[model samples]
Target chain A: NAGVTQTPKFRVLKTGQSMTLLCAQDMNHEYMYWYRQDPGMGLRLIHYSVGEGTTAKGEVPDGYNVSRLKKQNFLLGLESAAPSQTSVYFCASRLDRRVYNEQFFGPGTRLTVL
Target chain B: EDQVTQSPEALRLQEGESSSLNCSYTVSGLRGLFWYRQDPGKGPEFLFTLYSAGEEKEKERLKATLTKKESFLHITAPKPEDSATYLCAGRYNNNDMRFGAGTRLTVKP
Candidate 1:
């Protein structure tokens, strides 16, 4: 299984330009999440979905939007890319919300907003 | 606020050296603590999960132990292949998972 796969391994964006990072998981997970990792910082959740058609805000949801129209896909969109948004983005999925359930992560997408 | 802090920002050890990485966390309601290993230019890979205090889990040369307020990942006889940033995360009752800055370990032969 692919587990989780993210599109556009790397990208360079000009400020104010918009782009969407796509994430797909073949694990049939019930929970999917989008997180950003900045240098010297831990991963911060931007948005997540418990299931298809259900999206919720996360710790750093501002300036970002997400859609989970299908169970296997979660897309993160940056309406207007900013320098602050230049970071490594990761997508993860898990089978359930149980405390013991482990998350599987994708390779990650590196975004550089100049 | 929920937060996680990892110690010794970075560490370099000899091939046979043994060491432990610490992860301290605070959350309104603890659900679980997780450990992951991330290689350069790749995403984090799951290692273990501790659901409650006193719980322990192990994989190959790594062992994870959890306590009331912290978790420790013990690396035994680590090899160069084990070199990477180790991350710890805590899941709360609200379903939010907070991660630590991570401990970078470099095992040199």
Candidate 2:
């Protein structure tokens, strides 16, 4: 079902440059999340959406913004890239909070900001 | 604040050897504890989810057990193919899920 897919598997950016990473899921999940993974730091949530058009800040939402304009798609935008933002970003989705909390993750997009 | 911590930042084992990875969590109203295996350069793959203390789930050579404060992922007679980073996370009723740093497992064949 291509559970979840991410665009631009890899990208490089200079300080102050902006870009958006797109996440699409074919499973029709009602919840989607954006997370960044760094060495020895694990995965930290940046933002999440409970449904289309609804978004919430997560543990590490600074410097990033997100939008879920469609039920099957979630987008993460970097207003101005920073060196600290150079990490592997992952997208995840789940059916619902009550019935199934298992999140399906995308392959991840590796971002390098210099 | 809710948090999850894993022990033995990295582990190496010979083929056929058995070991366990630990994930300890501190969260209010724990709803579920999850286990995932991630390969190099790839996203995490779901393994198992423990809903309550004493809950156990198994898949192939891996078994996950949960307690009140921690969870254990037991690998039985592992193979090289089983080598990957193991991650655990905890979800509470009040907030989003929190993940541990993960334990990188390497199996030498």
TM-score of each: 0.97, 0.97
Colliding residue pairs in candidate 2:
none
- Candidate 2: tens digits of C-alpha lDDT, residues B1-109: 8889998899999999999999999956778899999999999999998988899999999999999899999999999999999999988763368899999999999
By DockQ, who's the top model here?
A: 1
Q: Judged by DockQ cut-offs, is candidate 1 incorrect, acceptable, medium or high?
A: medium
Interface RMSD (Å), every candidate:
1.2, 2.0
| lDDT scores of the candidates, listed in order | 0.92, 0.94
lDDT of 1 by residue, B1-109 (tens): 8889999899999998999999999945878898999999999998998877889888899999998888999999999999999999988854568999999999999
Each candidate's B-chain TM-score, in sequence, is: 0.95, 0.96
lDDT of 2 at A4: 97
TM-score of the second chain of model 2 compared to its true counterpart: 0.96
